[model samples]
Target: MKKAFLALMAIACCHFLHAQPTRPNQPATDPANTQAPYLKFPTIPPFHLLKLDSATYLTKDDIKKNRKTIIMYFSPDCEHCKHEIESFLSNFNKFKDIEIVMATYQPFSEMKEFNEHYRIFEHPNIKIGRDEKFFLPPYYNIHNLPYLALYDKKGNLITTFEGTQKVDTLMNAFKEKKK
Candidate 1:
């Protein structure tokens, strides 16, 4: 009886050891799930984010034509992010007409605080909004704060910057032809 039980135990162990997990079939890859959605989507994404007021929303339609756009991803408390904004603001004349949309995944209060601290209200051209959908981060593959995506007047991507900002460099890139 003992031998029979030992043999059965050994057989069960062997069977279990050799067994493969029946993994569920993987779903087909969606176009949006590609390596870099932005690479596939070179143009500015159709994003709808909540404005700082938490009342109205900012969307693709809100973007003005004949104006270049800068979609900036930032954290309000981030010093680097603050510096980037300062750089842009100091060179305000160059960026005055550019539509600047600052989106943050941080809480609305922080966004509001940052806006007030920066006196963003003064610049109707610069909009700081809350990304309630959390879209721009993944869309831009943001690994650092203050990621800026510059789009041409035609709503086509020029290039991107991570962790830093140079006003002259941005202006040059914005003038590039789309690939």
Candidate 2:
């Protein structure tokens, strides 16, 4: 009986010694943990998406070298998404130099209509594409509709925005100094 009691006490002590305080998982992009290979994972992973033209595709390779890039992820039926695009177009002249890649995981037909409605094709600086493989949201751990991943001229990620980002903030991010 004493041996059994000692064994149970040992097990309880082991459990207590091994106990860990639980916490939410930090994003892979968070810099504190260098073990995560995501922060400098060379431009938000290699993505292959279909362009608005439907016949052609837009891959990570197509992104212009030595140019700033904005990867805008949106949905067709989302009101916030519409506002986000409008906000961008309204401030286009200021953002003309920055390359924009608008992407959607929805149907091709819907993206086509949205593109037409916005006359996005007229803006050579912007390219709209379809994320058919549905890779981005999970990669971004996205919880918002209009997510924007902003990269600098050197192809390094400056930061990311989840929802409706102010035009001024966007501009400031464009001008963000290297860290």
Candidate 3:
């Protein structure tokens, strides 16, 4: 009887071991279950952000299919962000072919002020918007201000840069995506 009990206990232990949950730090083995926080290069994730108008929303589908996309995350209060925006504005002609989406988590009033100050909305290629719920920073694992994510014409991610970067560097990144 004791032998039978021991055998049952061993079987239970084996079953428990096999049924253990996956490690907390390890990603799931199932392809469907494993979704990275940030979209990898050549992969595009669906996103929805709010426009400064407080009425319209910009989704992945809103992106132009033929134009490469540059998504810039900025804070109105950050000096580096201001510098980056100024650089982009100064070199606006170089990026006329690309679609620029400048998003920020700052209040609508602040965003509007920043947009007016930089005349960002005056450009046909650039769209200044607000992300009120703060969805992007965490989704992209952004650790610094003036983060930039460049995507190909097909909407696939090309590269991501955190902190201030030169306009030429950004242009080159987009150019590299074509190759």
Candidate 4:
């Protein structure tokens, strides 16, 4: 009986000693704690991207202005991206007042070919470029192609959409932001 009692006491003491209190200054030791420390919003982050010309670098300051901006992340070989660009071209009149900046992490030659295929440069409001360093994918946590982030005239993020969104849906997001 004494041996059994001593064994139980040892087990209880071992458990108590192994369980440590979490310190206020230290991070959680739990391996299952995977939640982000903070929430991510649609605000534009500072980034340096190369234009299709491969000579000019467009920065965050260069794109900011007193106008709404639509920044799209796409891939040259993505069919969904092609569809989105086609939608924009077909509905160019509706987006005339908005600034459209399309960026891709693909090579300059591929971006040039894609731009030529769509003639995206003809539109004064549109700008297509390459993100050589691939900064946007991780920053935005992109998981799919044709990601769109719409910012208001004051450079505040209005909303973000992933995948192929209808033109009306895109426009309505901006309209709602205005309110």
For TM-score, the strongest prediction is: 2
Model 1 / residue 12 / CA error / Å: 23
Q: TM-scores, in order shown?
A: 0.79, 0.81, 0.78, 0.79
Better of 3 and 4 by lDDT: 4
- Candidate 4, superposed: residue stretches over 4 Å from native: 1-42
Ranking by lDDT: 1, 4, 2, 3
| lDDT for each residue of candidate 4 in 1-179, tens digit (9 for 90 to 100) | 99999999999999997797767777777834433211244456676889876788887677647888998999999999999999999998989998888989998899999989999889978888889898878776677889988888887788777899899999999899877
Worst 10 residues of 1 by lDDT: 26-35
Score each candidate by Cα lDDT: 0.85, 0.83, 0.83, 0.84
Off by over 4 Å in 1: 1-33
* Candidate that beats the other on TM-score, 2 or 3, i.e. the better one: 2
lDDT of 2 by residue, 76-165 (tens): 889999999999898898778888889899999999999999999999879889999988877776779899989888877888888888
Residue 40 shift from truth in candidate 2, angstroms: 5.1
Residue ranges of candidate 3 with Cα displaced over 4 Å: 1-36, 40-44
Residue 58 in candidate 4, Cα distance off native in Å: 1.1
Better of 3 and 4 by TM-score: 4
Candidate 2 has an lDDT of 0.83
lDDT per residue as tens, model 3, 1-179:
99999999999999999788779887777756665467543444566667767799887677777788888899999999999988988888888898888889888889889988988778888887787778888788788989998888887788999999998899889888777
